[model samples]
Every structure is written in structure tokens, then in C-alpha cells.
Target: MPQHLTIVTHPLVSHKLTIMRKKETSTAGFRKLLREISLLLAYEVTRELPLTTETIETPIETMEAPVIEGRKLALVSILRAGNGLLDGILELIPAARVGFIGLYRDPETLQPVEYYKKLPEHMEDRYTIVVDPMLATGNSSVAAIDMLKAAGAKNIRFLCLLASPEGVARMKAAHPDVPVVTAALDRGLDDHGYIVPGLGDAGDRMFGTR
Candidate 1:
């Protein structure tokens, strides 16, 4: 309903997302839910993909089958929480190429700075999907996009588990060309800039840290 943003409320995804939101959920469970949700989310993101018909001989007769067009896609994960979504998406698109972009948030300024970055060759030619778990302030997500654009990626899509209004605004202003996909857009960010009522630090929750 929010332009390019697609919020999925499917029963299965909603059920797992609710569990992941619960404070009582275990680290392993959180990780698993992220994976499952990522897979489901990926399905929605690729729903409108172009398909080509292929002629194949069946056991009884020859028939035409539909297959995805183009070469393998490029999946760029904005580490480290992005890695969480990466695994699940990979399970669905095993042939997808994987890339990593590491960003660190400065506690005082609350800004994102790059730590590491690695992308595949011919990124400009491949459809790129950038993965991140939480799009709270959008600082990290914005930085990641800027980095990607600087590198040769023209076609890009941003996928996240949850997004805040502020983050969405920031992205819309910064990279309107890139569509964003998320499960839910939370209330907003807390004083510390974390998404209010958010599941806390995504990486921490996934790794069993305080």
C-alpha cells in the first residue's frame, strides 16, 4: 500500500513473524523464523518475474514448461543481519550470486559507515536484491544503497523484515528507483534510533546476545 513497499500478511508468514516478535522467542527460533520469512518474502518479491516457455518431453508426451528468464540473479546482503535473510533467500534461489556489504553504526552520531564490501562481477547486468533484516533509521540501508549504486548496480531491490516510516522516507528520497519490500512497518524508532517496540537489535537477537 506504500508505493513500491509490499507488506505481507499471509497467515503463515504472519504466524512466524508474530513468534519472532515475541520477547520469549529463543535465539534459534528467531533465526529460523527470519529464514522462513525471508523465503516467503522472496517469493512475493519475485512474483512478477518474466518467464519463458521451454519445450520438454514428458514421460508420455512433449510439453511446454515455464522457466525463469535471464541468468542467475545477484543477492547482496547488507551484513550482518542481512545475512540472516540471505540464507533463506538462497534456499529458494540457490543459483543466485551472493555479495556482502558490512556497515557499522556510530553510537554517537547514529550514522552508518562501511566496514567491508564485496560484490560480484557484472552486477550492472544482473538483477540485484539487497537484503537487511530491519530498516529502522534507514541510515545503514541508505549507505548500502549508495555504495551499491557507486559500484555498477543499476537494477536493485531492497528487502527487509521490518521497516519504519522514517526509514522508508529516507529511502524514498535517496533511491526512489529501488523498490522496497518488507513484512511490517513498525511504529517508529526509539530515542537510541532503534525501531520502537522493535524486536531489539536483530543481530543480537539472532546470535543470542544482550
Candidate 2:
């Protein structure tokens, strides 16, 4: 079984995350780094995927080769910032079915408001992964997972570039069955509900909106 929370500590992941966190990193640079780092995170998130062996004939002999079991897994991006991580993970798992849940946080309430949702079919038969860039207050992440569960996604995992203790704890309380995979778990959320020392507004940095 996968741990409830897995922080990817690989040197390459760490180095790329450091570059991404720099305030001076250009939008192009930040976007490029996010794609690179996300691939590394995807590696860790899928580490425990079940595998089954199949007999195959090699040039020299016949042997059993392990292959991922079950139907193609689903990648559900919690949109806007989630697309950054989604693109890279798709590069690593091209055949995985894709889905999207569009949610925006209400500035006044800091609550998630769902605007759109389109998920692949047979979610219950697939291992679903919900990707988002930052897990701040965890309200949005929790809401996104709730939508997935309602759509029949029983086996699910959450992936992000950065997380906060408050956010992680909220997820644990709301959905203990799903595991979390992230590049880093930062200090905590600020009064405004942003992760402290975080790479300032992932969507803005990636898209140069700010």
C-alpha cells in the first residue's frame, strides 16, 4: 500500500523545485521547470501501481515481463494551475485517460466553486489521479476529490507540486483513502491562505498573468 503522503526527495526533483521557487525565475523558465519537476513527481506517484507478469519471448529466451494492471488510469486536472502538472504527467503516461474539473476559489470565502467537470468513463475501474499545483488551505483539493468520488472514482490519488501541513491534514481528514504525492511540503499557509514561501501563484507564474 502507498503511504498517505509521499514527498519526492530525489535530488533532481529538489534542484528543479529550488529553481522554480526563485522569485526571479522567468515565466518561460518557471513553466519549463514545472514540466520537468512534474515528470519526476509522476514517477513517485505511480510507484505503487499494481503490476502483473506476462510471458513474453525474448531474443534469447522466454520470460515473464511485468506490466501495469487494470484499465488505463485516469488523470484529472484541477484546472488552471493543474494544467501545468497535467502536461508533464501526460508526457510520461501518454496513454492514460484524461479528465478535468474546473474550480475557482472564491476570494471572499476561500471556498471552492465548481464551474465545470468532464471526466472519463468507467472511473471506478481506473486508478484516478487528481493533479493540482498547490495545496494551500485544502478546501479546493478536498472539493475536487469529492467530485471525483461522486463520479465513481474509488481508487484515487492526489498529486501536486507543493503542499502545506494544513492542506495535507485537511485532506487526511476528508479523504483518508487517497494518497498524496508532492514535490515538497512547505511551511504552512499564510493568513491569505497561500503556502508560505511558495512559488507565488503557480498559474500566474506559468502564464505571466500577474
Candidate 3:
């Protein structure tokens, strides 16, 4: 398990998750639920952000107020499905800087190979958050982290819609310094390497296709 794995089964998250779990849920519905869950997940993900006091004027009187402390945050989407989770997270943290990393697995080796990547400036100074809908084999998530590290991202966090034990273990071994936050961690991976009870290819479900 990840050093920090908050499996959110909250009523809101669970309800939306069930709607998405149904195989008959329309592509649009799946996409929408992912967005809802992402928003809820954002609540859990940013729970520990430090706060600071600031001087501000209230409607009634001028007084000191509490506000988010430290530097602006960064969000990295592990494309292309990661983009699904990214959309909702962005809603909650609209001011957060965004980044992307696209990777594919080698046919024979089943290892990760980077295809595309673009990140925000001064990533080293930002608290980075990387997201993906599913963490099955953990290949892509690990590879995505490697890309961020290569670019000098220090304070990094991982977010996902669903995860498998294999993926969780892989992340712990590969990037223990980083924390993983997910909504659900299912039984395990399947034959072709997808989460066993997972909703299916998150990209396909969200986009409506094979």
C-alpha cells in the first residue's frame, strides 16, 4: 500500500461510483461521474495544505483571515485518461498550474515508453499533483513520476480513480517519497492487465468507444 492511500468511499463518491460501475451507464454518464469523483477526491487530496493568517475586511468589520499558505500548486495529468480526472480537479483548483505526460507500454516488455510530455515552468518550486483514472499495472504512473522528477519536481502527489494492489506496491517501491491518493483500490489486475473489478478502460468509458 502507498504511504498515504486514502480510499474514499464517501456517500457522494460511492453513489457516483455506483452509477459509473453499471456497465449500461452511458459514455456521457461515466465521464460525468469521473468529474464528480475527481472533485470529491480533490477535497481529500488537499486536506493537509498548510494555512496562514492574512489581513482582510469582512462584510461587518476588518480583521485577520485564514488563507491557503505557501506556493501555488501544480497539477500533472497522466494522459490521456488522466485528463478525465484532471478536468474536475481543475474545477476545484482553477488557479493551479497544469502539466501533461503521455506514455505507452512496450508490447513485449510491458514497460513504459514516453510519447509526449509538457510541463509548467518552475516545476521545482511547485507542489505537484499528478492524476490518472486507473492504476492497474502502475507502469504509466511510475513512468509519469519519473518524467516529473527528471524535470525537478520535488513535492509530488499522485491521484487516481481506482487502483490495484500491484500498482500500489509498484508506486511504493518506485516512488515512496510521493503519496498516492485514490478513490478505490479494487481486488487486483486481470489477464490483459486491467483492474479486476474496475469499470474498464477509463478513457474508453469516458469517451464512448472500444
Superpose all Cα atoms of candidate 1 onto the true structure and report the RMSD in Å to 1 decimal: 1.7
Best by TM-score: 2
User: TM-scores of the models, in the given order?
Assistant: 0.94, 0.97, 0.94
Instruction: Report the C-alpha lDDT of model 2 over 27-54, residue by residue, as the tens digit.
Output: 9999999999989899888887889999
Residues 103-164 of candidate 1 have per-residue lDDT tens digits of 98999999998899999888878778999989988899999989888988887889998999
User: Which regions of candidate 3 are displaced past 4 Å?
Assistant: none
Residues 46-110, candidate 3, lDDT per residue (tens digit)?
A: 87776899999888998988888777889999878988999998999999999989887676776
Candidate 2, superposed: residue stretches over 4 Å from native: none
Per the 3 Å backbone cut-off, how many clashing residue pairs does candidate 2 have?
A: 0
User: Over 4 Å off in model 1, which ranges?
Assistant: none
Q: Distance (Å) between predicted and true CA of 148, model 2?
A: 0.6
Clashing pairs in 1: none
